[model samples]
Target: MKSLVALAVGALVAGGIAFAAPASAGCQAGWTPWGGGEICDGPVGSDGNFERCQTTGVLGFGGTQCFIANVGNAQPPRVGP
Candidate 1:
């Protein structure tokens, strides 16, 4: 029995990945804009000057590019799981 337990433990350790589960959560949609973000009214819009977080995404002069879930709340980014 001890040998079986030891073998199982050894195999798990060797696999490395079994140590812990992957962290949940990622850049949520309409949560916040990232990269160059998106433009709502037009593509050439500027930050704050032209765009604002909306349900569809950072709206501006053209249209939205980023997902809506990534650009809504005014709260700072947080870890989600």
Candidate 2:
């Protein structure tokens, strides 16, 4: 019984660490800051589960632009049942 309790506690600690936010190393390499978000030449790194916002749009005459933002501890979107 004692061993089982220890195992449960250990699992919880490990899980919490795994889901913790990554240290902000600023935007990923090659990604630049823009309007409080990031703009990358391509897809941003998945190191911190970074996601591109769904609101892609043009910035005046600067052509198309997209933004990437961290999703913190929020659950990922569900897929097909």
Candidate 3:
């Protein structure tokens, strides 16, 4: 029973999805802020997860918007579902 409980907890942790700054913006998906607004280049398909605001890290409230690029470089190619 203890092992089953542990397994359940592990599954729960694994099943949950982590939303990063870039991920929330849908920019890089995992890209995060190193601070000072340094130029960032990520691998293709790489996701950015920036964490600047202390409040809820979603779009509109200054969280990474999934529809806009945080940086001023060319946007990434849109991926098809």
Candidate 4:
């Protein structure tokens, strides 16, 4: 019975540690502070394009939005056409 109580206490301690772990924004690098939020570059996509992400709200209580754009689709400036 003593062993059972010890095991339960240990489990609770481990669970508390896991629960207290801080969450990450998953930004590879280049984190910039913005108005009440932050913006950063996200991981590359399967299409070989990069993703731009913005996170808002306090302590991640709000949400994060990601936008993906294809660099190949953009046309260079007309060069004084």
Best by lDDT: 4
Q: In model 4, where do residues sit more than 4 Å from their true spots? A: 1-35, 43-49, 58-61, 70-81
lDDT of 3 at 46: 38
What does candidate 1's lDDT look like per residue over 1-81, in tens digits? 656544543343334322323233332232223212211221222342222231221222122343232223423322232
Better of 1 and 4 by TM-score: 4
- Comparing candidate 2 with candidate 4, which one achieves the higher TM-score? 4
Can you write out model 2's per-residue Cα lDDT over 7-60, one digit (the tens) per residue?
544444334334434223322211112211222322335564444322111221
Q: Which residue pairs come into collision in candidate 2?
A: none
Output the worst ten-in-a-row residue range by lDDT, candidate 3. Answer: 52-61
Ranking of all predicted structures according to lDDT, beginning with the best and ending with the worst: 4, 2, 3, 1
lDDT of each: 0.29, 0.32, 0.29, 0.40
Enumerate clash totals for all models, in the order shown.
19, 0, 19, 0
Name the runs in model 1 displaced over 4 angstroms.
17-81
Model 3 misplacement above 4 A: 18-81
Global fold similarity of model 2 (TM-score)? 0.25
Q: Please, what is the TM-score per model?
A: 0.21, 0.25, 0.23, 0.30
Q: List ranges where model 2 is wrong by over 4 Å.
A: 22-81
Worst 10 residues of 4 by lDDT: 72-81
Q: What is the C-alpha RMSD of each candidate to the true structure, in Å?
A: 19.3, 18.5, 14.3, 17.3
Worst 10 residues of 1 by lDDT: 34-43
Question: What is the Cα-based TM-score of model 1?
Answer: 0.21
